[model samples]
Target: MPILEDLKEYAERATGLHRPGKRQAAELPHPRKPHVVRFRDDGLVPNHPRWPLTLYRSAVRIDERHDPAAVLEDLFEANGWGDSWRNGIYDYVHYHSRIHEVLGIARGKGRVRFGGNKGRIFTLKAGDVAILPAGTGHQCLSEEDDFLVVGAYPPVGTYDECTEVEDRPKALQRIPKVPVPRKDPVYGADGPLLRLWKKSK
Candidate 1:
């Protein structure tokens, strides 16, 4: 029955039947300050040297009465992070060198390792969001069956996945050049993300 509902919901979304902007939309409550964590380049991972990964716990309100992934999509798009996808995190270790990403946990929970082999595992639950700077490594160590995340990128860069050690040499060169996001996916221009990233430079 749940899968059936999910199928129907997906169909409606694809057909542009479910999204109501400004009205009938799920409200996104302002979240607390994010917890910032930095990582060193583990050689293979090529973690960002300046910008740190940002984590927002219970950052959004996941309403069960409505499709939660849509809530994230709407919010991210509004904040200049567009072209979102609904899916689970990749199980294998990987990092993005061409662009930064924001992950909104729409449903369920997962233990995600950030910063490659040297990273820490954090349990992310519904309504949580993680803002990954370019070159930061991330992987899903474990997850709930219903785990779903809404991932989006800023307009500034392309989305490229780096999964192999062979990708390192090029990644190290490309990572530093990846443009930092101009807006925070959750809080727009006034968010702490812009401030932190600016201060890092």
Candidate 2:
């Protein structure tokens, strides 16, 4: 519960613009909550610093982009350190205002749910992929054994230039109500970062 509280506080502080527009007093829903699977007992890594709540290193990165297929192949490939991708969760929550994400469920069953919306869960199994549009809040629900998720993003420096508009009017103006789909998709060959990860022998 402390972790959830902490996440809530962090989100509130990070956003700066609270419900009443006052500093040091803000409330925001915890973006995503994934039950701590491992890393709680001893630690995520051996002898790591132990705090009241454990924090696992996030494998996913805002800067890294790869192919869904190739990334999946590499995970199971012998030379690719098969066990490296065995099981893990990325603790880091990424917020990309300019880019969308393509998530591919490669080898197991899991759930993806966007924040602020209940009953919008998408359950995925092997070979199933979901495309999450930009600014749509989301988080992983559960990761079954050997669950593998591959994400794709735009080119290097593309997201870096992204601007986060906090002002309500500005943010509203930036986002179009018409919802025209982008020419280049976010998470697959349909995405901008195409073939970044290729199947290897």
Candidate 3:
């Protein structure tokens, strides 16, 4: 029998996972202000104090002609975010204590709850993007069957998912130290991320 990791890989491959179009089509995003929201550490979540979560609505153009995932993968790669993956959101509340994350919606729609229990819920659709600072809690509230998301991260941080109650202490210690990304995952060197985050600091 194959190892568990091999089995998972086989399943993903059989189901057509991580495959995007060969065409590279990412360009400038539509001009729009990133909607920013900050979350307080709710004991369990350890949300970032200085950087707020940023949301970009219809930031990129994803249409029927181009593979949506391909579009985002190119967009993110061009903006200096790498290690891209295509998938759906996790239903349970979870967060990354070490790395910041960027999620670009490729297909369908979903309602996602951000922050801890006191966090807000936002409906996301295709062409949308959400940038999560380190230690920010997020969960999938509801989603369409065809909902697909393209996720990537900045070059600076490591990726570690923290969910259980026991992950708090270290999360608190490490969350603040996650270095700010040099570029926005959506817009690039001149994007609003640099302005907003630096202004907050």
Candidate 4:
């Protein structure tokens, strides 16, 4: 409920930014792991075992005429994903063992670190999107003043934050139970997620 309120506030605050605008549809096979990346962990990110992290560079190609945030929301919603929210990434490290998360860089730019304290950092800008498997750690390393991000999760279960060491075992149990999302957050049914994730399974 509180998250819903946050989402509402974010939407209202950006109302003028979502007006209809022309832009090209996202082109896929754009880039996958290594350059974009797939972070792995043993039991560090307990629930994140089977799925690899995914990042798409310049996935949407932003411009003054289009709203990257609005387009990302529509894509996730159409695919039955919910719990959408808009904001910058948290400055401190955190992860959710309950659900996979997708973050679209809607405005400005920022640097994010993934996979705990030893994780690498990547710079992101508008039109970039990151799909984090459940339990993977992420934190904002730096950002521009205008940085804004749109994030959403699959429409199956509620999410819980796990920043403490004691939460590991229970989080591990919960993560595997989370069903693989039926649609890719950005590319719908035929997206790269299925192929990439299926290989891991």
Best by TM-score: 1
TM-score of 3: 0.87
Q: Residue by residue across 86-114, what tens digits does model 2's lDDT show?
A: 22224222233443344545455776554
Model 3 agreement with the true structure over 119-165: per-residue lDDT tens digits: 99999999999999899999999999888888999998899999988
Identify the candidate with maximal lDDT: 1
Candidate number that wins on lDDT, 3 or 4: 3
Q: For model 2, where is the 10-residue window of minimal lDDT?
A: 47-56
Ranking by TM-score: 1, 3, 4, 2
lDDT for position 176 in model 1: 87
The superposed Cα distance between candidate 1 and the true structure at residue 123, in angstroms, equals 0.2
Off by over 4 Å in 1: 1-10, 14-27
Better of 1 and 2 by TM-score: 1
Worst ten-residue run, lDDT, model 1? 18-27
Q: How many residue pairs clash in each candidate at the backbone level?
A: 0, 1, 0, 0
In angstroms, give how far residue 27 of model 1 lies from its true place.
Answer: 4.9
Clashing pairs in 2: 102-187
Prediction 1 TM-score vs. true: 0.90
Q: What's the C-alpha lDDT at position 48 in model 4?
A: 70
- Model 3 Cα displacement at 127 (Å)? 0.4
